[model samples]
Every structure is written in C-alpha cells, then in structure tokens.
Target chain A: MNDQPAASGTPASGGVRIAVDAMGGDHGPAEIVPGALDHAGAHPEDQVLLIGLEAAIRAAAGTLPPNATIVPASQVIEMHEHPALALREKRDASILVASDLVRRGEADALITAGHTGAAMAAAILRIGRLPGVDRPALAVQMIRTGAPFVLLDIGANPDSTAENLAQYARMGAIFAERVLGIPEPRVALLSIGEEKGKGDLRIQRATELLDASGLRFVGNVEGKDVTGDLADVVVTDAVTGNVVLKFFEGLSTFIFDLFRDEFRRSLRGRLAYLLLRPGIARIRDVFDYEKAGGSPLLGVRGAVIITHGRAKRRMIAFGLGVAAETARTGVPALIEEALREDAARLDAAGAGAEGRAEETTLDPEDTP
Target chain B: MNDQPAASGTPASGGVRIAVDAMGGDHGPAEIVPGALDHAGAHPEDQVLLIGLEAAIRAAAGTLPPNATIVPASQVIEMHEHPALALREKRDASILVASDLVRRGEADALITAGHTGAAMAAAILRIGRLPGVDRPALAVQMIRTGAPFVLLDIGANPDSTAENLAQYARMGAIFAERVLGIPEPRVALLSIGEEKGKGDLRIQRATELLDASGLRFVGNVEGKDVTGDLADVVVTDAVTGNVVLKFFEGLSTFIFDLFRDEFRRSLRGRLAYLLLRPGIARIRDVFDYEKAGGSPLLGVRGAVIITHGRAKRRMIAFGLGVAAETARTGVPALIEEALREDAARLDAAGAGAEGRAEETTLDPEDTP
Candidate 1:
C-alpha cells in the first residue's frame, strides 16, 4: 500500500525504512519496541526495523504492526561502557546493527535513544561521514522567543578548532534550510561578549574564519541572545553548546516544578492553576525537547537521530517522524554538497589566510 | 549617633564609607545618585561618596541625605571605551576616582555599575591584586533550590588554565565561608559532562588538580547541576561562566515574559494572573540579580563590586549593601590568608606535578 518511491535502496514501491536500536535507552526494549510499533502503526507509509536481542524484542514488542519488523542482534551496549571500546568489543550490538542497516542502504535512517557516545561512535565507524566533513556534529532544534533555531556541536567533539566551528556553520545552515526550512539561515558564533575580540583565542579565530566564509555570518552573539531568535543557527564548541543546552533543560524543569509546588500551596493557587493549565501546557510544549524529537548527528553519510535516554513512547514516535522527514529531505547528501562547495570556494581563494578552511574538507574517497 | 567603629581611614566612630561610581551605568548620575542617597538614608551608620562630574552629580543629588557626599571627578568614562585605555587616559574618571578612594583607605569599598572590563581594570590597576592572586575572579552569589551558591570566574578572565581554576576554588571557598557562611563549601568544576574525562584538556587537567588540591572538591558538575544546589561553588573558565550566567538571566526573563503574555490572552487567564501575582513576584524576586546585589570581584586588594550596567536605584542600593558587607567581613584579607595557606600546602606537597601553582603565589612585597 506504500505509494512513496524508494529514495535510497528499498524496493521502488516500499516506503522509507528506519532502523531503531530497540535495546537502547533506560527502559530498553520495553519502551523502544512499543514506540517503534506505534510509529509504524501511525505512519503506514514508513517501516520500522527493531534491532535488539531477539528474545527481548519479541517479548516487549508483543504484537507488532504490519509495517514493523524485528532485526535480531546478540549484544546491547550499556550506557556506562566506553563508546569506541564497546562498539569494537560488541560488534553485534543493537546500535551497530542499526547503523549497519543504514550503511548497507537497507534503511534510510537510524534512531537511537541509547548511549549518545556509542550512537555517535557507531554512526561514525559504520555509517561513516559525508564528503568534506571531518567530524559529525549534533544539531539540536530549540525554540526561543516563539521561534525555532538550530544549535550545533552540542556534544560531538569537545576539542573543536576554528575549522570545526566553520564546518558546523556550513552543516548547521544546510540543516536549518532543508529541515527547519529557513532560507539563508543567519549563523552566529556563541561567545562571552558580542565583540569580535571577546572569548578565548579559539573563538576569536573562529570569528575571523566565519566572517570570511561566504555564509550569512551575523557577527558574535552572547549566551543571553541565544534564546531570543537573534539568529537561525548558533554555533559553538561541543563543550559550550552541551553545557548551555543542559542548563536550559534543567532551568526549564526547575521553573515548572516551582510553579507546580506554588499551585498546590493554597485554594486560590489551585483554582488559578486549573484555569492556567492550558496556558502552562502551552508553555511546557514550547520548552519541550521531546516535541522536537531529538537532535540529528549531522555530517554523517546517512540520517541518524540521537534521542534523549529518558524519551518515552511518544517522544520515540516523534523521533521516527523526524528521521523520516530527514530521510525525505536527504539532508546528508545536501550537507555533503554544501561542504564540497565550501571547500572548493576556500581552495579558489588561494588558501592564504583560509588555511584552516582547507583542513576541514572531507576526504575525496569518502565522497558519495 | 552612629556607634559602628570606622573600619578604614574614616574617623574612629565613622561607619563604613562606600565610594559610589555616580557617573557609571546606563542611567549615569541620575540613577546612581539616588541609589547612594537611599542607602545613606537607610543606613545611618554608613556614608557614601558619590564620585562623578561635579555639576551632574550635584544636579542628580537633589537634596543629599545626611551621610551622602559628592566627590567631583573631571572625566567620565563612557561605557564603550576600552577599559585599560580609559583608566589610563581619563585620570579623573568616576570609576578611577572611586577605586582611588578605596585605595587610599578613605572608603572601605567601591561600587560601580559601569563597563565591567573597565571596573576590573580600574580595580586591578588602582586598588591592585591581593598577594597570591594572579588574576581577580568574579564571584556571583545566586540562589538555586532555595540555597545560596557562588559561581566564580563569571567574566573575569576568559582565557584560563588549570592553575587559574584551582586558585578560583580556593578564593571561592573562602568567599562562600566568610560571606555566604557556608562551612567547607563543596567546590565543583563545571564541564560538559559529569564524567572525569568528558571535557577538553583544560577541564581534564583542572579536574585532576581539583582532586589533589586538598579543598572539598566535589568532582565535575555539568551545566544542569550548576543551579540545583549541587555544589556550593561552581568553578569554570570566565567564558563558560559568563555564558551560563547570562543564559540563566535570559531564560528567566523569557519565561516571565511568556507567563505575562499568557496571562493577557483571555479573561480566565487574567483572573488566574491576578491570583498568581504573588507567586510570580516571589519567583521574580528569587531570580533577581538585584536582590543578590552585584557580584564581588574577588582576589583584588580592596573589595570592589561590579554591578549590572542596567542597574537601577534598588540594585545600586543593594550593591552598596554588598560592598558594606564585604568590607565588614574583611573578605579580601580572608581570601589572601586562605590563598597563602593553599600555596604553602602545594609547596609542601613537593610541587613536582603542579608547577603552575608556584606562579600564582602572591608577591611577598604586595602582601598585606
């Protein structure tokens, strides 16, 4: 019944297939299997391949929907294990199998709510990176001032250079344009102050590189401006972005909890809360990370979503939607093309002051 | 009939005198003069020296309170002027004059809401750094989970090393103990993740140093745990700290604005707002930077408060109060002593691995 033409390697009449790491996250198969089944049921045009230990997937999935199938893997990567080591030791891990599916072109995308480090490792080691891409960045879609913006390098490579940030700018712009649908995304460098001279040497160098690059560079933006829709894309080193993102999540939760406690304090508060429930829910949804599904591991050869470990069924279903959307847009291919163009521009500029830009070019052999 | 003893160069019976930068901040003398007057009016035992251009200060002063006096400064440093240059060129600038007052012991402390870089520059060049302080760190007091905590290096030195972080831990602990009355404050290094090896090399090295520093090092704290009473002192490089602090302010303001807009949407929402006003106000007050006054520029020879540039009367008054409290508690002296002890401990530990610790020792000639 699927009508959408196969974009990758599935049958011409088959829909986009998503490989899900069902043995991932805190709840393991119990949460992930049903989530995949639900998503498959909801979107009949898409298929889900649940990857995990065979017996556990069977037990947790119960009765799968028509579009859902189980792909058995003998091992599961635990959250605490070292990412690279675990991926090497556990070759048959669910995350690895899911990545392999995407690598082999059997699946259009892979979704994992498991260990972030492991998922990234598997994607890099198996699915590989897009051409002209050195490191894959985690691009998170967040809302600030009633508008959505993308923040990148949110825990990919902590020791990032100016070149890495510049690459992030290119990849992030592509993601913003194709996925977020913002034409000519305004990219900002996250620094301590708005001044070009502010922040550390790395930031200063990145500022120079971004300014010279042909992107719509909107100078420096501080942390205060991050949530104000000042730019379509905010770029930073993984350390800073990860910290800021977590802080945002934590503070939002804390504020909501404070409101909840205050509402329960008195009769007037209770009545007020009842009246304000809809408004509060609206605010909650605006701040909800789950609503955005999860961040994409940008610059990878195939679409991969690294969801939150605490994600529930609904969040996973939404993640499936995100993966499908990414697959449909073919963001990885677009990113590769953009990076190639960016590299060519840098090379044509004679590589005098833009030596850093030259270093970020993806390997030719890796090009699709 | 003030009974408080003079702490500095004031008369034996004179109370703490705080030199106020009357021409500083966005409102200039207009906001600062009234703020100083208010503080002097409320605290009969305290005196305020409002330093600025003579005519402007007098015009804004209106009818000065009993304990408030105006000190004429020929030059007023504009907010945008480079800090070090302004301090050198504008010899009689209000910020410089105020710092001079503290340096001469005519005032126990100095309060400025002007350009932060200029304030730090003026304080460092005029009042000088305490013995054993390589760089002065900014320490901000904030409330999270109903408990007061201190965050340091909140824009003092954007470029920092592991040694600077270790020094901050010492100074921060001292400030927390003496000012915030937290005994043996738990100090945590801010990083992207809680894992020991999660962040960049600087963070990893800082983590190792903190572990061996003999302080109550609480390992690593991610951004999410920074505001939840997870650590009594959260230490980070200036860039990260500044970004996180500003992000907190921005997010809090955004959430409040969201609430305000939601409340105005419908009649029931308006009613709920009327009932919820008290709770909202309480939340606002809790997150108010003004209520906590300005952050103290720690490790300086004299107590200097770097208040917000947009600070109004109430915030300025609170800043004066903070200055008085810092003077009363002898925080600078205590910090110096604690740092000295920490240095000696490191020296006794053979200084084999931590050679950087020796470079931060206070100059013997500069010691109090």
Candidate 2:
C-alpha cells in the first residue's frame, strides 16, 4: 500500500489515474470490469486501477486493457451494512483499498457504484476532509428545461447546522464554477417558498448567513425552482436534498414506464412510437442520469464519485470519466481555497456581528 | 347581505349549497361564473351562491342557471394583498363573504380559487377551527401510476411541530378514509429515508408520536414513495409538502412541454404525434391536476377548498363538486370527532408520560 510516495500538497499531473471499486456495486465485477475497460479504451491517457478480489476480476474482465490493472482486496462491504462500522472493521475492503490508492498518490481519484453511505465514509475516513471543512457533501448536477445546476448535501449529513448549509453553498458554488463552468454562480437556499421567512428556523438562519457571506445569494427557492433555472447552485441539509433527488429519480422513471406501456397498448400507438422513437430518445438523453455521470462527494481531500447503486456499464464508464475530469481540474484544491476564503470573511464579519453569529449557532436546547 | 334567513347547520336540505368567490381568482368572474353554471347545470338540485360585484358577475355569466344566483359583494381580495390585513380591512371581500355564508349555513361549504393565503385566513378567522384542533392542514389528493393518495399540510402551516404533524396524520388519515375511500388508511411520515433515525429531530419525534397515535402507522416513507402505493396518507410539515407538490407540478408540466416541442420538430415526429395523440392524452389524464379538484383545508369547522390560483372553469366546477361531496359525507364532522378522540387519548397519555410530552413539544430555543 505504501509502495509509492504520497503526493503531498500538490495535485496529480501528467495523466489521470482512477481507482475503481470493482466489487462495490450491485452487479460487482460483471458490470464494473466492462465499465473500467470502456473508460480505459475511451480515455487512452487515463489509467484505471480495478480494486477487488483477483479471481472475480479475472472472471469478469477476461482480458484487460494495457492502461487497466487489478489491485486485490479480500473483503467487500455489502450495500446494507452500516458504513462507518463496516469501513472500520474491514480495513482491506474494495472501497477502502480504492480510497487508499488515492491517499497514497497511486491514483488521482476514486470511483464507485457501491453503497453511497459506504463510499462517503471511505472517502472521508481514508482520504480525509479538506481543512476547515466540518463535513463533506454530495453535489448532484441536475438538468431541467435545458438548464443545468448543482444541488448539494444530497445525503452526507442528515442533521446539518446553519454553518454546514453556508459551507455547502460555497462548495456547491465552486463545483458549479469549475465543473459546470457557470461564472459567478448564483447560490440559493432550498426552502418551502421564495419568501425569506418561509421555511423553518434553520432555513431562515441559513438565509441570513448566505445573504451576508458576499456570495450571489438568490434568496429562498422552492422545490419547483430546482428545475426552473432559478439558481445555479441550491443548498440544503442532506435529508431534504436526498428526498428531493430520490423523488425526482422515481417520478422520472414512473413517467417513462407509463409512456412505454401506453405505446404498446394498440397498433396505432405502436406505429406512433416507432416514428417518435428518435425524438423520444433525445428527450430521454436530456434526462439521462448515466450521461450526467455521478454525484461528487465534495469537501474531501481526493475526488470521489458515488455513482447510483443501480448503475450499469454506461453509467459506471461515465462515472470514471467524471472522476478523471474532476482530478484534472483540481476541484478539491479549488474548494479548499474557497472555503478558507469564506471562513476568513466570516471571521472578520463575526468580530463585528458576534451577536448574529451566536444567534445562528446550533442550540443544545433545540434537541428533542 | 342577509336577504335570506340563515339556514342553521342542517347540511343544506334538498341539495348542497356552495358559496363561490367569483371575484377572487386570477380571471375573476369570467372563470368563476361559468364554473358555477357548470356545477349548477350538472346537479339541478344543488345551488350555487356566487359572491362578487353585481355588474361583473352579470357581465361574465350572461344568463345563469336556475339554481345559480348572484350574491353581490362590494369588494374583492387581490391575489397579492396581505391575507390577514386585507380580510380585516375589506370585511365585505368576496372570500370573507363566502366564508360567512358557510358559517351561517347559507351554504354548506366554501369554494375559492383566490389567493391561497387569503382563503386560509378567511376560513380560520370566519369559519373557525374544529374543537380540539390546534392547527388546520391543507390536504392534497395526488395520483401517480393510477394510484391516489392524500398528502396533508401542503401549505396551511409552514412551521409545524411534532404535535402538529401528529395531528396532521390523524386529519389526513380521516380524509383518506372518508373522501378517498381508503378504509384503514396507512399513514406515513415524510422523511429523507425509511430508516428509523433518519431525518432531523422534528421528523424523528413525529415518527414516535404517529406510531403511538393508534393509527395504522407505516413508519417513515421517503419522497420517492409519495408516487408509489406505499401509504394512503403522507403527512409532513407544510414547507416540505408544498415544495414536493410544486416540484411535482412543475416537473410534470416541463416534461409534457418537452414532448410537445419534440413532436413538432420534424415531419416524422409530427406523424408520430398524430398516432400517439390518444395515448398521450390518456397519460396526461393521469397527471391532470384539474381533475383532482381543490385541496381541502381540514380541521376547520366548515368544509373549505383552496383551489389553484390558475384554475379555470372546469377546475372550479370540479372544486364545487368536491365541496358538495365533502359536505354530503360530513367530512368536517368526522374530522372533528377524530380530533376529539385523539386529544382525549393524548390527554390520558400525557398524565403518565409528561416527560415524553415535554420532549415532543416545540422548543422555543429552536426558533432563530
């Protein structure tokens, strides 16, 4: 594990290296091997280190590309296992081993289609969090009405304070700027309504902090605004964000299934579906989660993408590409700088607004 | 205003009567008059009492049905006007007038497509709350995959406590049973995950309360489960519920618009559209908000419906139908009885479980 010297304080360069958890996803090596091969073929300059049991990797991959290699790990974390507990118990787990490669400068980034909680746990526990960052957040890039934006804290911290929300705004804004290429991203707090005092106390306090933080604060936005281009980056506690993301995924699938069933109901419908096939395909492409790659777990020292558990070869391949691209852009370093700058600004402001800061802090008496 | 003697709470004999706020919606009397006429025409025995300026009502309605009559009000509440302030100042506003009709039993129920805030204010201030009911909730009946479910506190109470959510569960369960015909409705708390300790403290506390409330509690259901057949009644604070509802509405509209634009792009696509017209129409019918009628503001002494501000004639007619059906079934009376029973149970439990009751109470320190 310590064969290569750790890359300290500098971003990986020359060519990108991605550590993929080949045994982590629902389909295991069967899906992960092909996905890794696909990525290696498409991105000739990038290398994929497939981490899993040697026998399973060989059984699935058969013949690997020149740029792809297998790194053996004896244990695997199941989807339903408690993330932190499992990570601590199985030190040589595929996800942990993949994260270790990133930590030791053997790989530039880590990619997995495994348990989301486990992926976040491994990334934070193995690779570590950026300095001054209290918690890492999962940033998802969503498209609505042909407009793309980022939403953060999708499932990392279930109970987040106003401070965590403010930090998410900063991290999400940076991700949108560096990855999504939105200049001076407009950050919005996801609340019940657009009014300032619409949501609960946590939201109200977060709104105030965001307004005073000098970001392009766009006031409060509702769930409808997530797909309305109302903001470039939307921030919320993990609970609400996770629910919204899942709901979007479920509803999208439900609608498509309904359409498919309708098209097969009659001969006339079948003919219509044939003619409309290409157009419908294009519409599906616009909403395709696979094409969007994976959601990046931000605030970690290394780039880690937590792909959907139901992801196939296409989604897995796209996830590896995303990992390579994120590493190339040095997004983690950029996020670290942004957070430091934000913290310094808050420190200066806090000197004069101590009362406001104390008012917004999490209260112990609030716990039930 | 009192030309006819007030028919005290005897459920509007012969046929149900609905007080319509003709001047309250975006389209004013133009939309409301025809909707009233439609309802009156459909149900000959039922009566429509249209409240608005006399001239405008006559101009828009032309000739009303035999059962439809204009009950003129001198003022109207604009959609943007402050709900409580305007209701106090404009005592004769159409919304207020309609509420008065329901309160005095001139009409069995109140129907309005006006400002939602205004409508809720008028209902609570004029019609009053049911006995043992602390907060009223707006319950929306949603359909997905041809399955219907009731969601409560959609916009009535934005900041809700555990006790309030517990009450919403009871109210929503009764609504599902009486109106939606779901006997022994399964109630679920809207949360980020299905895990017991998933969301914030408020949600966790609410889960405990619901479990002990003696209903068919189905534990916690995520946002993805809303459109699924996981539960009959999904209860949440108004903020989250409103966001989910609006997002569903916006996303549905956005997807259909995409399909429409896609079909019009080329000749082949257009041909496909023609053949798929009927199938697509059927799909649209499944997600049609207008067909669902208005969401009921439960926990009030009288039946009150808050229809969408953008509702048209057909939607208004359906809303009136909902009002008549609710009155006929005595939903308000049923809700009152359920609430009294729940209150009694809580009171008995509170004596021995004072610590638990105090822990569940809304903490003042939580308010920022």
lDDT of 2 by residue, A90-122 (tens): 888999899888878788888898888778877
B18-89 in candidate 1: lDDT tens per residue? 899988779998888888888898888998999988899899888888788888898888888866667768
Residue A70 displacement in candidate 1 (angstroms)? 1.6
Q: Which ten residues in a row have the lowest lDDT in candidate 2 chain A?
A: A359-368
Cα-based lDDT at residue B161, candidate 1 = 82
Write down the lDDT of every candidate, Cα atoms only.
0.80, 0.80
- Collision pairs in model 1: A132-A362, B131-B362, B132-B362
TM-scores, all candidates, are: 0.90, 0.90
Model 2, span B24-137: residue lDDT tens: 777888898888789999999888899989999999898888898999899988977867668778888989888888877778888899988888878876777777777888
